[model samples]
Target: MRPRLLFASAAAVVAALTAATAPSATGAPRAAAAAWDSDLAAAALSANPAAATASGSQSPELGPGAAFDGNGATRWSSNAADNAWLRVDLGETLRIDRVTLDWEAAYGKKYVLEVSGDGTNWRPFYTEDAGTGGTVTAHTYPQEVRGRYVRLRGIERGTPYGYSLFSFKIYGGTPAPASTTRANLALHHP
Candidate 1:
């Protein structure tokens, strides 16, 4: 019975992976659901690589990619604009639970953490009006939002310079199908 159960579990995993990797009707590859404990912002994920972009950079060296590079020494600095913003493409739509903003000397006094399915339309999940800089961790736990693109829009600058960030880390889980979710819930409940 143990061997049979093992084989059944393996088969289920394989089928789930296959379905998750399949392309959608729109011809765009589907966003694979990731483990709830994993960091969705990590570029190391070969399946869905995350990328970062910004409205404007202070210089070529301090580009947007530096913020998501997982290197503390590097950072992304925006130009002198109160409305400067930084966005990250999570490669797949995810249920974002939390976000950590490691700010540099220059930070946003008033900013909004927004999520979007398309890059054009955005919905704010977190807003900081009295930002003291440093590191800010915003948890959307009880009420998580879903989107592929996450943006940090600055409304007011904390410093005389522009907004700067050492890192913009995102934490989320991939959404499961209704059937899979129900099955898991039933298994645990029973």
Candidate 2:
């Protein structure tokens, strides 16, 4: 049997995306913003490429846990072993509302989720004792909780050790104020 997500989260994600861009009462320029959900794992790259650089990630990548073995880099999982991570930089303060981790049936173990603004001061989001590969665990973060970066540490994988992945979605929260044309120009100038 194929593995499945712990929650019907994909549906919920699509719904949110639809709602955000639906339209407003003003009937003016409210601006279209990408919903936290939806099929945005790719679009997120364009929206925040610098974030990828900040997290040491590449394009078209779902989460952080890619094959970074070339540099002999040590991962959070095992030493000289199987493990991966998908860290994200929010670019600005955001009240992390929800998080979803998707993996393969091969990862029938467990792991941890941590968030931080300064990157040094960390806090645990959730610690699942058991995980079946192909499941997605969704958890609501503290409403007042805020951060600029999120690091998914695959501390442990399922029985048959390996990495499982598809994507990681950091759900809704308010984005910072609208950026002006002059500000955007200044940012590009170094």
Candidate 3:
């Protein structure tokens, strides 16, 4: 009886260690899921004025428009399908240097980030085969990817439900710095 008790305790310790290292149903580890990529990236270009669309919305309230509305409370959710996708159209063609995915509870296990100029022809800039699904920031510098339309094509769903995103933010050119000069140009009386 004493030996059985000792063996049970050893088994429990091994099980705990295995669970800690194993990938959860969410796809990646908890640490990677909680943080963004460590890089000083560019600002998001797909905010207001940008139109968003998707393959299929889970419901009227969870439309693709909610993803780019700049509201954390709102989100875009697709129907329960692995092929569901979300797309955003920047008003003009711009160099894409970074992208951030603020995923909801239902995330994508495998997805491809593509950019296109004509909206028909797409070129993948980033491919996420293993996603943990929290806030993922991807930098595409030196790849020279430029496009007006950016999209995330879901190849595999992380949850039984479809893919969902709070924000599908695209990043590009450097943001302008604030003026340091204290003198006001409009103050001239000449």
**Which numbered prediction scores highest in TM-score against the true structure?**
1
- Candidate 2 on 1-190: residue-level lDDT in tens? 5553343345665675566576667765443564555423234444565453223322334224332211113221222223445566665556666776555444526567777888777787777767775647556644455677776666565755445455556676566444322343232211
Tens digit per residue, CA lDDT, model 3, 1-190: 2322112344664575477667889888632111123211112223343377789998999998888776789899999999999888775667777888999999999999999988899999999999989999878867888887889999999999999998877766422223212232123332
lDDT of model number 2: 0.52
Q: What is the Cα-based lDDT of residue 58 in candidate 3? A: 89
Least lDDT summed over 10 consecutive residues: which range in candidate 3? 33-42
Cα error of candidate 3 at position 43, Å: 11
Local distance difference test, per candidate? 0.83, 0.52, 0.75
In model 1, the Cα lDDT at residue 181 comes to 52
Q: Cα deviation of 40 in candidate 1 (Å)? A: 1.9
User: What TM value does model 3 have?
Assistant: 0.66
**lDDT value for model 1:** 0.83
